[model samples]
Target: MIYQTAESINDGRAFLKIDEFIKNNSVYVKIENMNPGGSIKIKTAIALVDAAEKNLDLKNKKHVIESSSGNLGIALSIICAARKYNFTCIVDKNTLPHTIKVMKAYGAEVIIIETPHPERGYLGARLDYIKKRLVSDNSLVWTNQYESSANREAHARLTARELLNEFPVIDYLFIAAGTTGTLMGCVQTVTEATPATKIIAVDTKGSVIFGTPSAPRYIPGMGASVLPPLFDSKNLFDMVQVSEKETVQTCRLFARRYGFLVGGSTGTVLTAIRDYSPKIPAGSVVVMISPDGGERYIDTIYSDEWCLQKGLLQLQSSTSRNTFSGAVVE
Candidate 1:
């Protein structure tokens, strides 16, 4: 077990079969949390940097900036730290505290946006800040995950290939969409290779990614108040929007049942799978991506006190193992 570089250590990640969880569906989860960045976003971080270098942008630019909820910020922080570039991550108030700490620990200047727009929400506020800052400071290069083709292309080239190679003939792929980079990347790959494989794009209830109304979305990894440029509705097989409550319940259920502390996005996908099991045919090879583990979410998604403060305590009493119906919470 020897490694050359810590920044680009994202290949052949472990994936496992959890077929017993859902009946009639051979459920499989790719454990992407094993990466050095502790999330599936490591691929995109590398790709974005590589693309920048290829275009000769990174040669003169020493400072890199991006607006991320949590995972991608940390990913870029790791890369920027390794490359000796000054990294500034503009995140909103909803991002997990541990996530902010991780980004900061990786030598990133973390900027927290405490306000949200009337309709656009914190995402819009973050974007506005980036735009204004970029206008003022010419040295800062905004990664623009929402609009960056590299964000989508990176997933298409790396993650999509990883998924297709692991499960060459999967019946369905469930992906939680934030910027829609991951989901669209798999969509592009599967559409070109296995057209029969359905792409189930999972979004949170408060997200506007799937025509859902925008609101205060606390969970970081999934859901977007603004529609991402990478999102394409043409090839989507279906859409499942899970609530914050359902996400908390499913995460707790996994922690209780399998002793695996999954993050909020993974919980949302699992909740979607549980609620959408009826749509999947019997014995279907259902594959999903677990973007990150639960360590970084220790404050919010994994804390009962935080949940109580956020008014999500109903999950412990209302949700059961058998019933995880996706109800609107925010």
Candidate 2:
């Protein structure tokens, strides 16, 4: 029941200035927003849901439950809506309003939970709840992105293939670590297509992916308080942890410099690139992945008041806070 849409590769590069960046730094940025759902999660959504239908009883299932804060949930909601499947998502309290609206608009039941839990965020708790519910009723399918091999397979098959076709001689691949599906898939692709390429896993300071202490993380994706079972550290060359402030600043810089409005996770990769680009040899091709678009954060990171309130972005000295629109040059 895969819904087909016109490919967006034909969309002009005006929104994504990959050409200029490539010309200046021989590095390529793969914009995954070109996908129909406006993120790379579409690959996983299609793969996981299709696999569920094949392996489990999804046709007459009452609901498909999963935990996600952003793009993955939206992707699932869209797919479920198209196929007439009942979709339910459990998300953290801090999720962006736009994401919730999108999920509800697609007719997916939305559940919000409190954040900063002993088991990390809502995902772990939601998984626990789903497990308990499954005990009572075995009809629902739990598409656990964190542990699903299908997630990794999706990236390995689609994203990796696309990257190999786009760049035959990639020297470095940078991706933000979340469920580790994207990173692992890209690693699998690089191993087969460009074995010599280095895979840099970027994480956030608060994410437990590297055993960091729990904190109030502003970024929607990239950092998890727990290491997902799918993450294979052996496949990575190095892991770099970027702070929330760094992620926010980088997102702002990216928007101003490239006019590319991507999510905070994308900022993590860009920050890694800015730090590691100089160390790489001349003319080596480094490809950074932008997982999703910026529309979801219009009321948060993309908002001037929100940035100032959170002390994420500051205006010029002597300029009244009221005049600060997050666009003031530093």
C-alpha RMSD of each candidate structure in angstroms: 3.5, 3.6
lDDT, candidate 2, 1-330, per-residue tens: 345322223221222325434323655777877676688888788777877887777866847888887789998998888788899888886678888888999999988876445665655666676678779877789888888899998788777777787777888888889999999988987887777888899988867887677666766867786669998888788888887666677676667666778788887787777777667776677787889877777788777687777766766656432233534433
Where does candidate 2 stray beyond 4 Å?
1-24, 314-330
Backbone clash pairs for candidate 1 read: none
| Residue 133 of model 2, lDDT score | 72
lDDT of 1 by residue, 72-95 (tens): 999899888878889999998888
Would you estimate the TM-scores of all the predictions?
Answer: 0.92, 0.89
Q: How big is the RMSD of model 2?
A: 3.6
lDDT of 2: 0.76
Error at 79, model 1, angstroms: 0.7
lDDT of 2 at 329: 33
Instruction: Give each model's whole-structure lDDT.
Output: 0.83, 0.76
